[model samples]
Target: MRFKIGIIFIFLCQIAQAQQSEMTVNQNHYDSEFKANSELISEFENNGKSNAEFRLIAKSNDNGKISVYIQNNTSDTISLSHQDYSIYILQEAMNKNGLWKPIEYWESSDCGNSFGEIKIEPNEIIQTKSTKYSGNFKTKIRFKLSENNKVYYSNSIVGNINPNKLILPNDFSFTWPLAIMENIGKKTPLELQKKVVFLEPNGMEEFNEFFEKSMNKKN
Candidate 1:
């Protein structure tokens, strides 16, 4: 009986040690990611474009698609790259809690040769492209565009169609890094992809704060 108890105790000890090791590895992964995200956020704050005069607007056309337009109120020409102009922009939904979450609009490989630029001359109001929202989610939805290494958001419109059902859980939240990472596989810029962080559970407030601070454009 004494020998059997000794073996059981050793087995338990091994199991405990293994679990502890796994947890340590997970924690280390999270720590590394957090540190990397901090660095990326700092870099973006220093270099990301902040043209308050630029206006991004979205309106439902007579057709089923939403037409997006970029009004260049800036004095300089704006160059928007990543070729499929409007396809990869994120379709964001406002949850019941008033927090925003992204519902992906396009699904395609980003490893393409779509590095071409589309220039909008000064004082030009150009139509970038249109997106068809085919989902069943009815909420206040908006478009988030990352073009020319700068981020711009559109005015909110009602969204009742969410085809892919890509909506996040009610408890889920939004962060710029998380939103950018979710769209990384879908033709997002390589520079932004390299700086993305995993989805944060409660970063909605922080995300809005960052947007407000960086681009305070009125809709």
Candidate 2:
């Protein structure tokens, strides 16, 4: 009896240790790498193309994982979490032959069965998982043709974010034999796959268009 009890205690200890190993990232993981070019900012305003402002809003602490958000200069309240923001991390190619890479995305993994929406007033911020983890931005670079048929890039690009998603449970594991097998290839609630886009002067329209399509599909 004594030996049997010792084996049981050791097995329980292993289970507890395994459960404690799951880790989330630090607050800094939610930072954005979306840097707007000063020249582009100036050129857009000079050309009378500036209509709105785009910025990131994030929150984190030792008690919780970081949450990321986007603030837009608009007039209506927006429901963002439902939209699942997609991010595009932009890479600069030296010879125009460099390939673009995917952005670093983040989002809430644990969601209760209850669902609620946060109302974002105009010019208010809405949340995104992509921003909460870590991010990379992709700008759609545009170049102008001169009269000499030469390509002169004002070195500016327009970028946009798009959304795709999956709905899953928050729990990462179910040690029960059947439970483990049942969840194979399933998505987790924390799995958010939305892209947060940075709009150049001309990207606003496309962003709105993408947003509208996302809503339609959700409905």
Candidate 3:
């Protein structure tokens, strides 16, 4: 019995060692491929020693819409706040009245309040539907990351808010910044712009009625 147990332990050790060796080899290959990839337009490292890396790239599809892909480029796993992905109007992008507020948006899969861990192994990519803004709106994204029960923030991206083309076959209803949309309609200042959140048509009627009434009271 002792001999059999010893043999089993040795076999388990061999399997673990093989896995670690394979992971090391794959990591080296990923580093090389990442350096050679030309599609990567920009990259960002975590402000601190946190081993999280981010990459941004854009591509045009057959439908004539541009798809902006955000990539994770580190060996360590990252936990992201899935719900607080907002389209923040940069300080330079704010106007005199401060009409633009950070528009809160959520994906269908990310609608619930949950802490999701993003484990994009080296050389892997993840995709999500970005906020569809209109006009010349410059913007950035703000969210939270978790490490050892402590939360850290990614830096505010400084760049143009690429207009993601969202087309509807019918008259889609949307609610933008009330101070901006109710007052200025679509005429924004030359510098500052608006981000509209297109509500799904399923509960459009009820939501619009309730939301408009609530805003009227607040105003």
Residue 69 shift from truth in candidate 2, angstroms = 6.6
Error of 1 at 128 (Å): 2.9
Q: Which ten residues in a row have the lowest lDDT in candidate 3?
A: 23-32
Stretches of candidate 3 exceeding 4 Å from the true structure: 1-37, 41-68, 77-101, 105-118, 135-219
lDDT of 2 by residue, 68-170 (tens): 4444435666542221223222222122234432222222223343233344566554433322221133333222211111112223333332211111124
Please write out the lDDT profile of model 1 over residues 1-219, one tens digit for every residue.
999999999999987554322211011000111122354334334544655645666767676666665555579987654333332355566766888665542232244564356566775555544544543457887876654335568779987653344432232223223544353223433323223322222233454454455444432
Query: For model 2, what is the error of residue 202's alpha carbon versus the real structure, in angstroms, after optimal superposition?
Result: 24
lDDT of each: 0.48, 0.32, 0.35
Encode model 3's per-residue lDDT on 146-197: one tens digit a residue.
2333333334443333232111112112223344355443443212222122
Q: Which one wins on TM-score?
A: 1
Candidate 2 off by > 4 Å: 1-69, 82-97, 103-110, 113-116, 125-181, 184-219
lDDT of 3: 0.35
User: How do all models score by TM-score?
Assistant: 0.49, 0.27, 0.29
Please report, as a residue range, the 10-residue window in candidate 1 with the lowest summed lDDT.
Answer: 23-32
